[model samples]
Each structure stands twice: as C-alpha cells, then as structure tokens.
Target: MTRSLHSTDRLPASARAGHWNAVIAEAYFPLDLTFRDAARFEGQLEHSNVGDISLSRLCTEAVQYERHRHHISSATEEQYLITIPRKSPVDFRQLGREVRCDPGGFILERGDEPYRFSYANANDLCVLKIAKPVLATKLRNPDRYCALVFNGREGIGSLFTTMAQQIQRHASSDPNSDAVLSRHLVELLALALDRTSEVEQGAGSSVRDAHRRRAENVILRDLSNPDLSPEIIADAVGISKRYLHELFAEVNCTVSQFVREERLKAARDLLQMPNPGQMSDIAYRFGFSDQAQFSRLFKAKFGQTPSGYRAQITAACND
Candidate 1:
C-alpha cells in the first residue's frame, strides 16, 4: 500500500490543540502532548508498507514535541526505528548519545528504550521501522547495531544510499515489487551495519598502509571485467603480476580464484534484480562469455543454477 500526506491549512482556533494532539497520537506518539500556540501547528505524514518494513515520510511546520515511549506487545520481537532526515534538522538522543541529523543523515533507535526526538521548523524526515529478529538473523552481532549514524557520502554508506534511492524509486513505479525490494533493502542495511561494526571494533585494516590498500582497491575495481587477468591489473597498477599473485596468496587464495568469486557475486546481485530476460543474459552482462561455463561456475559456488536461484528469489518475493 502507498500513502501520502501534505497539508497547508490551520485548524480552528478552539480545536487547534485537539487536532494537533490527534495527529501526533496517530502518527508518532500515543502519549499526551502539551503545547503553546497550538494554532501554529501543521504537519503531514506520508507512509507506505513494503513487506515487513514500514516507511514514513514526514514534515512539520512548527511544533515542540515532548519525550515519549511505546511498548511492543510481542515480548519476543525486537524493533529498530531508523530516521533519515531529508530537510532541516532534528535533534535525537539514544543510548546516552546526542546526534543532530541534517539531510542525508540517519539515526537508529531501539524500540525497548525510551528516547526523545525534537524537530525544529520546516523539517522533512523519513522513518523506517524494522523487526530485530529479522536483522539478527542476517547480522553477525545484532546487539551492536544500535544508535549508529551513517553519512551518505562515502564508503559503504554511499552504497546504501544508492540502494535506498533505487528501492524507493522501484516501490513508486511497481508497488507489486515491494516484497522483493524490501528484502534486498534489509540485506543492504545488514551489510552496512556489519561493516560499521568492523570499523568500530578496529577490525578493518589500516588504510594508511598504502601498498596493501592500493592492491586491494585495484583488485576490487577490475574484478568484474572478463579480461581482468592479474597480469593486466598489475600492469595497470604499475606492479608485477608476480607480486599480485603473492598478495592474494597471503589471503590463501589465487588471484584468478578471487576474480571468479567476485564475478559470481556480481552475477548473483544482478539475478536478484527484477529483470525480464533469460538467465543467460545476466551471465553475459557480468563478463561471462559462455552461458554453460557461467552456469557451471555459479553452481559450484552457490550450489544452485542461475535459473534455480532466480526462481527461488521470485517465489520468495511473491510470498
């Protein structure tokens, strides 16, 4: 279902307080609100559901909101609320930390905890609610994925920003595709959380180590090209092909093997898209020259043929 709300009119002078109270109760907090000059309050909430995820786009003219909390009826279910601000700014507090979110900034809050969010004048926000168990099953450590901020301008954050925009566009164009898009969006979120956790735990390698970082970056950049031979990549990076082999050897894999694995991962991502074509087309697009060769390699890596994997994703999306 798709829902949108936009309003520009004021409520009756006598009923202004009640009108604002009702709107807040229905959309955000189910708690009491005390306000001054309620005659100035005006807002709208645009929301939509895509499978298990609920998205709400909100905007407010002027209002002072109080701190509030809500309890979930299901004891076993955990909830995560993520807010992405699109316009103006919002001040948020969670887990003993305070954050100011502007456009392209996001904040995560746990449902079981009480928090305060204050939005200033003329603010636009997008809120996404996700179930904890759903994310726990995908992440390495679920408890660590709280109160994180993602700046949508660099690294994995940039990738996630692109994915979110794509999903939103697709949801608007083909509502029926929501189920699949939502699932992928969750996975993307999970991956982002995991990457962030790694950075926080000091698990990521030091980028200041120029040699290792540059070599890794070069391999990643050319991993999709069918002609991504180690010799060619080494030449492009001004390194000997033998050195390239030695670098990957430290990771217990050959350069060629890594390239193949990367290509297969790329192919899998493409197959998951809602494309109207044969599986062979997906294989070819990912640098596979021969369909049968691609099938053999993909099946070996994933234990399923391209067609079989596509069918499974389609069925899951429909369900």
Candidate 2:
C-alpha cells in the first residue's frame, strides 16, 4: 500500500509544523524538525512498506532534522536509515563522525543514536528504514558502514541504487512478493557494502584487510564442514594459523567464535523457511554436532530456542 503527506494541503500554516512532525514520525521515527521558515515550509513525502523495511521518498525545502537521545528512548526497536540524496548534498553527523553525501552517493544513519542531518537547499531524498537485526543477517557489523559516503554511480553501489528506485516505481501489491523483494534488496546492499574498499579501510593495512576478507569467505563457504576452524581457514586462504587468529582478533573475536555465530545465523534462516525440516537435520546441516548443543547456543544468542523461534514466526504469520 502507498501513502502520502503534503504540507500544502488544506492545512493551516501554524498547524503545518506539528502535522508534518507527526507525519515524519509515523513514516520513519520521532525526529525534531527545524524548518528554515516554519510558516512557509514546504515538503512532501510518500511512503510504503516493503516487508519489514520502510521505503520513502521525501522532498522538502531547506530543513534540519535532529534525532536526540530523548527521542530514541521511545523507540520500540533499533533501526537504521540509508539515505540517498537526489537533488542536493546532505550533511550527517553520527558517532562522532561527520560526512557529506553528494547526489551520486549514499549514507547510513543510526536511528538509535543522536545525529544531526541537514541540507541547506531544497532536496529530494530516498530513505530506507530497516531494523538492525534484519540487516545483520546479510552483513556482519552493519554499523561499520554508517556515516560514510558510498558511490551510487558505479559498481555494486550503482546496482543497489538502481534497484531501490525500481522497487519504489513498481512496488508489488502482494505482501509475499514485497517481502521477498525486501530480502533481495538487503542482500544486494550487503554485497555492495562488503565489496567496497571502505569496509575495513580504517581498521588497518589494505593487505591485512584483504586477507581477512578472504578468510571470511572461506568460513562462509565451508560452514557445513564440521571441522571448520582457524587452521583450516588459514590454510585455505594461504595464510598462517597465527596470522588468521591475529586478523580475527583485530575485530575483537576469535575465528572459532565467528564460525559458530555464522552457523547459528544460517540455522535461524533455515528455521524461517516454510518447511524448515526436522530440527536434527537442520542442526546437522549447519555442522552442529548435536541438536542439544544447537538448541543451547541458539537460545543464548537469539534469546529463543529453534523450536520457539519457529513457533513465534508461525504465530505471527497466522495473525
């Protein structure tokens, strides 16, 4: 379904700010809007839901939007915004880092944090509001991509930007199709971000980052192998075992821990399928030695056992 809000509609000038504030909050989240001229402010927004993601196109006059700590206190879930400016540059500051995203670039903003985003000129923007957990499944440490400008004019970034516009232009009315489209968009986004040189550009040397990326790919590919370990990954990537361990340590996790977490995430994805299969089979497929251990670890990480999680999803779908 599609919905829209216009500031110029029959609403009174004095009521425009309050009404627009409510519309912005309802479409995205609570935000403090400071219009260059509140009484003469002009803006328009159209929003639609794509599965668990919210997509919106906003056009507005000069304005500054602020998400303060108090506004975050009322948020029921943690969300991130991927903003793409179409007509002018956008200035965003978050996590002590600031960036200016040009028309051919995009930036990620953390909704749970305090940030100031503004544009001095009239601007048109494409914004995606997605929950953190939903994005985490596709990319590890999604927050690392925040507050950085990404090229949307070439490479995978261009593909992602094109897809987003296409989805907005031809949004499916069928809920199931919309859900699938949302998943594809997020997967593409993860690929675009992961392939970028900026992914770990600030972490260390480019050579070390390249090796780490290779190691991660090896782990993801051979996740079904019960013996997947630091030694095996190191050998597969032509790096020493100690070097592999050191690489992972730079990210504050051991190789074994990364493997286990990936397995759990894969298993959870399976459980969400229409036919997830028997618990034992699902666990074994992910290289879990036994269903009991899988259950314990899954619960510890996701706050629910496999069966419980599936049941909850089932109940929600039914409703």
Candidate 3:
C-alpha cells in the first residue's frame, strides 16, 4: 500500500530539494519552506493513505517551514500532523505555544493554523497526517494538543510509538488491515495525550476524568433519546446537573456540543455500513428529532449529506 512519492535517488543531485518540495505538497498539505542548505538539500517522502489517514515517513535535511495565512486558506482538508521523529528533534510553534520534541517524543501540528515546524538537523520523521474530525472523535477539542510535546516513550505513548515504527517497517499491509490499525493508532494517541493533560491538571484530574467518562457512557447509551440533555445524562451518571456541565467545561466544551458531535460521528459510521438502514430511521436512532435536521447537520459537519457521504465513500472504496 506504500506509494513512493519522492526520492533523491531518482532525480539528479541538482533538483533534489525542488522535486522533494513538490512531492511533499502533493502528499501532505502545502507549506512554505526555507531550505537550510539549498544546494545540498535532499529528502525522501513516501506515504500511504489508509481510509482518510496518511502514514508518511520523510527523511530530510534541516529546513525552516511555515504554514502561514495563505497556505491555510488554500488548504482543502483540515489535519493534524502527529509527528514522531526518530533521528532528530523538532522545534514547533503554534497558537503562541513553542515546544521542542526530541526523539522518543511527539507533537501535534495543526494545518488549519499558522505555525512553524522545523528540524535543526537531518531527521527521519514518522508522521500520521490525520483528518481533524477523525482525531476529534477520539479526543475532545484536539486543537488544545497542538504545539505541546508528549513523551512517546512512556506508558500508552510507548505503545503508540512502537506501533508507528512497526507500521513503517512493514508498510505492505493490506488496505483493510491498515485502516483498522490506523484507527487504533489514533485512539492510543488520544489516550496518551488525555492522560498527560490530566496529570498536568493536578489534583482535580481523577474527578474530572471519572465524571467525563461516566457522562459520555450515559450519552452513548441514550443517544436515541431526542430528549437527552446534560441534566438527564447527569442524573443517569449519578452526578449533579451543574457538576456535569462544569466537567465538560473543563475541556472547553458544552455537554450539548459533545452530544451533537457524537451523533454526527455515529451517523457517519452507520452510513458507511453495508446496509445502513433507512435514512430516517438512522437519524431517529441517533437522537435527531427529524430527518431534515439530521441531513443538514451531517452535511455541515462532514461536507456531505448522509446519503451523499454513503454513496461517495462507497464508490471510492469500490474503486
């Protein structure tokens, strides 16, 4: 499933950097680059797209790169490049946050935001270029993870880093297996980041985490109830209504927002099934009071109505 996007070995030494830049833009998003050593610059980029997620590895010389206002506006897809560098450190700046991640650590770089990501030396980087919404489904408000470094060598991070390394080494996995593995990778990455964020939040971490999980479980179980609300979910999970609202607040989200997002994600997945059932039934089952409301929200969130998404994704898979 691996596609060799670019290699210096194919081109004459003269155009290595130029050709490399073009290949990178084609596979990943476009970005402005200032080569540290233009004349000597050479790099390699190979990628495989599993589902909508990209597993890419780039070996390159030092370069100062920026995804600025122009690039952000021109981009088609919103993504977060979860980087795991094997050879050198990456200095990334985003949302007024600057962080350095050495080998055995990783950072999130947003494509929708202006940011700087650079390696001061040659690097062999393993990056999972994931769609923003795909990652968001696993972790709430993923933007807050940007520009922060997490130790890839610890706890769940250890498993995540190891899996990425193994996947790169064996890039010949079939599409179906690769897609499943990629989803697991995202889940693990989200868990590691959530755990890290919790630890940093000090004493309140455990309570917040407990409440959040319980509340989410209630939401999932009662998604078909159009009347489901923060109050209902709170009572179901045995927490005060105000406390439930505050718990979601700590994650910079509202309970209703979380519920809506989960519903949309659920609808999207059901649509992709072999037989997704009647559209109206699917909508009602996910707590949408009306089919039209479901259609509008689906289109707004996923850029396509439920039926359109099903048809388009199905066709793509067949191809």
Best by lDDT: 2
- By lDDT, the candidates rank as 2, 3, 1
- 1-319: candidate 2 lDDT, tens digit per residue: 4545455567779988998899898888999999999888878887888887888889899999999867876778889999989999999986556788999888888887678999999999988889999999999877667777888999889988888877876767788898888999999888888875744447324556787899999999988999887878977886556557877887899999999999999999988889899999988999999999999999999999999999998998899
Query: Model-by-model lDDT, in order?
Result: 0.65, 0.85, 0.81
How well is each residue in 65-129 modelled by candidate 3, as lDDT tens digits? Answer: 88876676667777888899999998987644567899999888878777888998999998888
Instruction: Point to the candidate with the largest TM-score.
Output: 2
Cα RMSD for predicted model 1: 22.2
Number of backbone-clashing residue pairs for each candidate, in the order shown: 0, 0, 0
| Per-residue alpha-carbon lDDT of candidate 1 for residues 60-160, written as tens digits (9 for 90 to 100) | 76455544333332235557777777777777664345567777767667665445677656777777777877777778655444555667556666666
Whole-model lDDT, model 2: 0.85
Model 1 — TM-score against the truth? 0.53
Q: Tell me the TM-score of model 3.
A: 0.61
How displaced is residue 74 in candidate 1, in Å?
9.3
Report the CA-based lDDT of candidate 1 relative to the real structure. Answer: 0.65
Error of 1 at 213 (Å): 39
